[model samples]
Target: MTAFLLRKLGWAAATMLTVSILVYLALEVNVDDVAAKVLGQFSTGEQREAWLLANGYRDPLVLRYGRWLVAFLSGDWGLSSHFRAPVIEIIPARLGASLLLGACALLVMVPTALLLGVIAGMRPNSVMDRVVSVFAILSTSVPDFASAVLLSAIFVFWLGVLPGTSTMLTGFSLSELVLPVAVLALYSTGYLARITRTAMAEVMASHYVRTARLKGAGTFRIVFRHALRNALIVPATVVMMQVPWLLSGVIVVEVFFAYKGFGSLLYDAALNSDIYLIEACAMVSVVVVVLSQILSDLAYVWLNPRISLSGAERSAGVTDA
Candidate 1:
């Protein structure tokens, strides 16, 4: 596991470097002449050139990238053009809110998805199975933005039971997060439930499940202790993959609910053409995605001993000797 973690960390560093390059190039395409933009039409051409040169804008692209990379490594993520604050400082404040929202959404999604999946898989052709299948299909069909709007109308407008917008601070209660969390949870539950159901169904049909049943094991014990544990392996991987997806894809949901999360911050940065903030956001997102993939791979090894001994050994640092 130590060797495996080190390998993953190395890959993560490489991935971040690539992501930084891409983000830098993307931001470069946009107008980065902050001096020109801020100085305006009244400034003469020579004055603008002088200002740009003084700020090191005259440097080569490679030099600029090297400088940015060095600064980023040292915890200075550059200054935001719009907010006029360091990217590092602005990001962490919003990241906390995003993490809180993601946690709440996962809390609501995981158990509900697992329960529905297990029940459906236990009796494949039953009415409950059909109902769950239908719901899963419907849940995945609508996009998150539409769901957010529909939820807002029903829960906030019609029922007035939850706040339409969330003011998520350090001291904010969970009630402030309920509506946004529910929207995100409901949007993701269908996909996870379907994946779980499929995995569980396959496990239920295995020979060991039949043997356990024939040995007079109770249905709950046979399902939960044996089949469900193995069935959860795939779904758990899917759940881990959702971390990056939620982190980035929650932009629309966050915008709709006026929730101040990393997603919302990214959106604002893009709209305002804040290159520094955008780069920071993109880098953070890429890091999250790569780390999530690494975690999912490790989970696959941990869940299935056979896999750990076989294919996982090659890349996961598990030696045959």
Candidate 2:
């Protein structure tokens, strides 16, 4: 376990470094271009140059990147030109909001998908299976923005029960979050359910499951012990893969709902070309992606009895032997 974690952390660091380099080069290559962006396109060349010089943007590229990296590591995540505040100061609340929204959506999506999928798989070609199949296709077909608008119209305009926007300006309001969460959950649930259903069906048809049936094992015991863990392996990885999608989807939903979250911050940064904030958002996003993958792998190790660090290492050693 310790060795596996160390290896995952190493790969995560390497991934973050690569993403940071690419994002920095892409967004920060020409100092004058960034200066013009930060200063506004209409600003005079002299004003832009002066602003660049004042902010130490004239430094060599390598030295500047090194400085920026050190400062980022030490928590001095440069000022956001768009917000006129430090990037570090701005990211926490926005990150928290995105996390909360994502957690709620997953809380709704995971169990629902897993349950619907397992039920469908247990009786392939039955009415329940047909229902789950149709539901998956329909849900996965709709885009997040479209669903967001549709739900808003239904809940906000027609019924007049839910808020149209999730701004939550005064404080965090569950009522305001309902539409946004619903949109995210509804959009993601289908794709995951399909994957789960396939895995469950395959597992149910496996030799061991048939053997269990012949042995007259209790249905509950057979499913919980002989099938569920193996069935969940694929969906666990898919769920982690969904993390990036969910985060990216937040950009559209957050903007539509006027929610002040990480996704909105990323959108605003890109819209205004707020270089520091963009870099911060990019790196932070990669961090989240890599970390989620690590957690998924840990879950993988648990769900898959055949896979383990020490066992795999010993197997490799025996292979060499």
Candidate 3:
């Protein structure tokens, strides 16, 4: 397990480094002059040149990349052109909001999906199963923005149950997050439900489940202990994969709700051509994705003993011996 963890950590580090370089390069390509972007178009040629030279933007691409890399390593993410603040400072505040929203979405999505899916899987061809299947399909098929709009219209406009906008004044609170969280959760629930249902159905039909049933095990024991554990293995992986998707894909939802999360920050940075801010957002996103994948891989190994065993262990006749 120690060796496995180390390997995963090493891969995550490599992925983060590669993603950072790519993000930096991508951000660099979008801007003609970072200093000009900061100073505005009204600045004269000499003024622009001086600003560029002073900020080291006039240096070669490699040199600039190297300098940026060193600063990033030392925890200085540079200044945001749009916000007129340090990238490091601005990112965390936004990230906190995003994290809260994401957590709330996950909290709602997991149980709802699991319950619906398990019921569908257990019943197979019942009316409840069909209803769940149709709902799952619709949930996964509809785009997030459309869902957000529809939800906002229904809940905020007509019902007045939840707030339309996610703009919080002093500090973060649950009320401020409700709409955004619901939007993301509702959109994601369908995918998770379908995956869980499929996994559970497969587990229910397995030989071990048949054996457990034949042994006269109680229905709850057979389903929960024998079946659900195996079924959850795959769904858990799918759930973990959603982390990166939530981090980046929430941009449209955030924009619609006027939520100032990482996704919104990223969208603003891109629209304003704030390369440093964009790069920071992209790098942070990449880190989140890589770490989530690592967690997924570890969970996979934990669920499947065959995967947990070392290659040498499998090759040797250890089990036979």
Candidates in order, TM-scores: namely 0.91, 0.92, 0.91
Off by over 4 Å in 3: 29-32, 309-321
Which ten residues in a row are the worst by lDDT in model 2?
Answer: 312-321
Clashes of each: 0, 0, 0
- Of the two candidates 1 and 2, the one with more favorable TM-score, higher being better, is 2
- Please give, for residues 168-203, the per-residue lDDT of candidate 2 as tens digits: 888879999899899999967988888888999999
For residues 226-289, write the lDDT of model 3, one tens digit per residue. 8887788777777888898898668988898888889999999989978789888888888888
Which residues of candidate 1, in runs, are more than 4 Å off? 29-47, 169-171, 313-321
Residue lDDT tens for model 1, 1-321:
787778778888988888888877866633245555545546788888887677677788888778778988899887886788888999997988898889889999999999999898888878988988999999899888888889889988999988788855556867778878888898689888888888888999999999999999999899878998799877877888889889866788788878888999999998886777888889888887888878777877888766753366353432212
Candidate with top TM-score is: 2
Q: Which stretches of candidate 2 lie over 4 Å from their true place?
A: 41-43, 310-321
lDDT of 1 at 204: 92
lDDT of each: 0.81, 0.87, 0.81
